[model samples]
Target: MATLARRALWPAVAAAASLIAAVLVAPAPAHAHGVALVPGSRTYLCYVDGLQANGQIIPSNPACAAAVAQGGQQPLYDWFGVLRPDAAGRTTGYIPDGEICGGGTTKYAAYNAARADWPTTHLTAGSTIQLHYSNWAAHPGTFHMYITKDGYDPTKPLAWSDLQSFWSVTDPPQSGGPGGFNYYYWDTTLPAGKTGRHILYIQWVRSDSQENFFSCSDVVFDGGHGEVTGVGGSQPSGSPSASRSASASPSVSPSASRSASASASPSSPAGGGSGCTATWALQPSQWAGHFQVNVTVKNNGSSTLNGWTVRWTYTGGQGFEGAPWNGTLTGQPPNVAVTNVDWNKVLGPNASTSFGFNATGTAPASAPALTCTSP
Candidate 1:
């Protein structure tokens, strides 16, 4: 009996060792096939929104920030990892309703939130567009593109029943690689009559492995070519230019109440003066549903600036949390006016200073362009 038990234990140990070896030799788990880029998917575009020049992920889009606030930064960093290793090309009952965006996995669950404020790609209905699917970890696969059925409401959780197969491509021509401009490219005509907001659900069903990847690209059929909203500004229409990086540029025009951009010229000052410009930045915060705003006042004139004032309106229902620092705050929500205190009022030519305040609310999709004035 003891000999029999020893033999059984040896087999178990051998199997365990084999499994460990397989795990050790597998590709990095965080890296995966990739997500939609042309009409950027939620995770892909949010990753683009939050990525700073310093390699930090700080989302400026309210929807992106809310997703980050719920799931932290891993989902965005692993933006391409929204997959189910055991799915085996399964749909419907496999990935539950309401969690389709995240592939029914907790790692990317935040993206499953039902909201209309997500960064959006604009396209015309029935137009032929090139689909650029990333090849982060290239493998033989068939790409299935699905669109939400007509009259679909984006404010509700997504259900598989809402999607209808639109297009698919098998092993399309490949270009770029493991990083920038890398993707499996193909062109297909979009389904006709899709208007307003809808989710484009994509599945990369690998022919070689059971591993499958999913992406949710929020799009609108509003006659616009390929401009995006809620991510600082509109992305250039058409395929992403070679000069564009994985993270799209955030310096373009602002998206109404969702974000703000500096005007071409100094905004008309309260007293018709125009010697200063103000730019606002959202600072890192530890709490969810809250943000810190930092506004910098720069003097562009040749003479000394004896005093400065900055004013802006908030349209997203954000309210101040506490008294501001280094400045005096006045007015109320939807309308904010700030002026420098005694210690930091004066500035020489080309000099700058900043003031900050905390706010209680989800980050707005856009910030109001700030206008600075001097008396």
Candidate 2:
């Protein structure tokens, strides 16, 4: 009996080890492909660093000395970076300078001081805190950054001083350029409520190689009192603006908000159109595969449609296919499905567009209806 129990325990232990190995080795998919810009490329890098503590810069770390060694130096980017009070302050905001490293051979960046006001919760003696970090670009690999508390120390290695950490953002090795965004959270504790002034230093470098790239940001935490002041800019905002939201089931209205109908004609082999009609007819729904559905779209509007968006609710398990400029559905659903059109297509006064997807369950006895929005 003892031998049998031991055999079972061995297998369970082995299985757990295998699961751990898989998680550590698995890689994330890359959003971008290759490196396009160089150090001196036409584009320059920008960054911002800020902090807030108990009303002063706590000189518990040697961040300042490290910054001076790197050649580029500046006082806290802005005096009024961000102010927060427990009773009212959100305790969060962007750093000053808005742009850190730019247009030259500058490698190091620094944020000299940050302070929190009185009546604020400060770090207790020997407590651990965490800092959150994120990357939003197409760089091929990960990198390392050093942190020093109090005043900067030149003799000690920042990386070895329990003050440094490394983070990786790439899944597969590639060239370099702009990649997707990566997030990291770090922590360290303080020695009692000894909060007056504090300093933080940040250094950027490649993950696989020693080559340094553009920008990076660090989220700092000291006990319960914290701030997001950093040495770089927040990721660039408002670029390929696209977003998606999902509805678990379909919905129907009592009266059709908008309707359209088309009259098939031979002269216009494709189809003919009228400018004042608001009615449209859909051909019998067809199955793309055991798990997919497809539908044809027609224009039944009076004027030309610069673009159109169609939305519908599904009762059967259904899914969508995402597009580069649009969203898609995938995987088998248990009950319903939905589809959304893009904003780029243009339909003539009576023109049309067609798009659809696969579903898990059988189509409803009555075909789901479609509605079009014209731009």
Candidate 3:
């Protein structure tokens, strides 16, 4: 009897050990997040160009190809996270020269190399246009947009002094999207007298943490309107004028100075005029630079809300940490949209489901605005 009991115990113990090993070996979830310039950041455009029918990436642009070949595809996988989270908002003394495009990180080192062959967006010089910054996730703080001075060389590494900031806004407005690709939109005058190829360097600094994001968008001041070349896409996506939700950018505020306290008008609600009603409350776990909100979405229609989406704007600059139930939470502060996940798409008449997110910013005194829709 004792021998038989020991045999059974051995098998049970072995099974338990295997289970523990499996649990311990499970892969960690992807936690990468960051911003991409919408004419598409270098990584973003290349990512768009490289996306395959099977969903794997294979770079078609020469620069992108070389970059991947040099750094492997992991950088592109976290295309938005090409940042040094500890930048402390420093421009030159901290980040070495030539590494400005990649924020002095090794993963994106290839992007820092000087090369005129990178993709370029065509725009008119001194054009007053709304700029869109794709938020893979939202973060509070400020956005400093600078353009390389005219007579700048694209074939060399970008230097801090080489940039001339045209506009800066703190806690601007935003629009949400699916897949963590929300965008922050604001309007400003593109540098005038700029001709030929120039680099648009962006720095996103978070207020609560040292985390910061960086991007280098290549542009040419030409007569063309919203035209992007060298990436091989038939049409450019993510341009301010592109037909994307929450694409409109507010004109530069009269002050246009680098002030974080300015107010941004709420984004135009998504989902048409309206169908459903939404309410928001910032959860209790909020602090100086961070907070979370629970948005309760109600189905007002007589029939089931087979699918639904909700859009809102938080006047404070806020960044979401990840997708909510597989739905994308995107947009800069003052604007956000949350769509449904496959599992939670159905809502019977008068039914409701709550979606929430933890964001990196201070909560506004009032809920910005909400527009809910279904189809």
Candidate 4:
């Protein structure tokens, strides 16, 4: 984990600024809003890994600090916002191979460096897993997920030829979750017999805008189930904190919301003046008469720490199937509820988090409008 400080967004989005002597016609960015993939994106995990009890960030992980040195601290400050505003669904050929991680941005080029020692999530080979994406800004979009081909080496620069997408979904199912996290959720089946470590890449291309968000999540197919062991969590070295630094940047604080309600009005964060917001995606399950859901919530509030609650109604008369993990759930059919578990309930201004669940429905019908509330 690289140490980092909490960043406050310049609300109302960002104005194009000239920096690094790079002359571009597009406006400079201010608030980065898009996603934080779970188990976690590189920027998101590194941000968490670098945090200290005192809310300071000086990267402790060797890779994270190296990334900062290469890319500068600004990209880490805007974790959710790595994008190509001009990419019109072009992949492989469109983005330069080495620059994929940064979306070809000079500021985030360090992340494109070929190296090991980055944080990783552990999983079983060929397991079907749920995926979550945060909503810093909500827009209708399609998601594309890919994995590196077998025998591909992480030590080498990433190329488009080295990856093959396994999943491409358009507006998957999602729930309006709490804790400042409105997420988009979908299930993916890992390729069979995949062993060792691999890179899980994600691309979120918005239909409303040309901008597209990307992510690189590290995973090891070690039959460990869904346990994520790296960065702020555990470690492949069996240690939480690897190398430590005396001086750290300001820590990025995560906030959470307590409970949400089924309401007509959307839950927009109180980002002083700007309307920080949250959004949801809900799709029908491929399984027999089931529904999968995701909610992507944003935290652009004045407060640092927060909690949340999520509520909804099954207009299709469907009900939940079982208990969900990482949070608590209640109610049935028409009126449903879920609250943030003790662990995940925090968001930083312009930051986001995510959660998910499933229900009994052949196909997802129009659910009642949702409302997320905060602490």
TM-score of each: 0.57, 0.23, 0.56, 0.57
Q: Judged by TM-score, which candidate is best? A: 4
Task: Arrange candidates, best TM-score first.
Answer: 4, 1, 3, 2
Error of 4 at 134 (Å): 1.1
How do the residues 20-114 of candidate 1 rate in per-residue lDDT, one tens digit apiece? 55333321236566877666788877875665423346777788899988998767767778898988899999999999999999989999988
**Would you give me the overall lDDT of model 2?**
0.26
| Regions of model 3 farther than 4 Å from truth | 1-29, 177-179, 233-375
Root-mean-square deviation of every model: 18.1, 23.1, 15.3, 15.9
Candidate 2 least-lDDT 10 residues = 248-257
Please list all clashing residue pairs in model 1, or write none if there are none. 177-182, 258-365, 258-366, 259-366, 259-367, 260-367
Q: Give candidate 4's TM-score.
A: 0.57
lDDT of each: 0.67, 0.26, 0.59, 0.57
The C-alpha stretches of model 2 lying farther than 4 A from their native spots are 1-126, 138-145, 149-182, 186-195, 213-223, 227-375
What local lDDT does model 3 show for residue 132?
Answer: 63
Which of the two, 2 or 3, has more TM-score? 3
TM-score of 3: 0.56
Index of the highest-lDDT prediction: 1
Off by over 4 Å in 1: 1-29, 179-181, 233-375
Clash counts for all predictions: 6, 63, 15, 53
- Supply the TM-score for candidate 1: 0.57
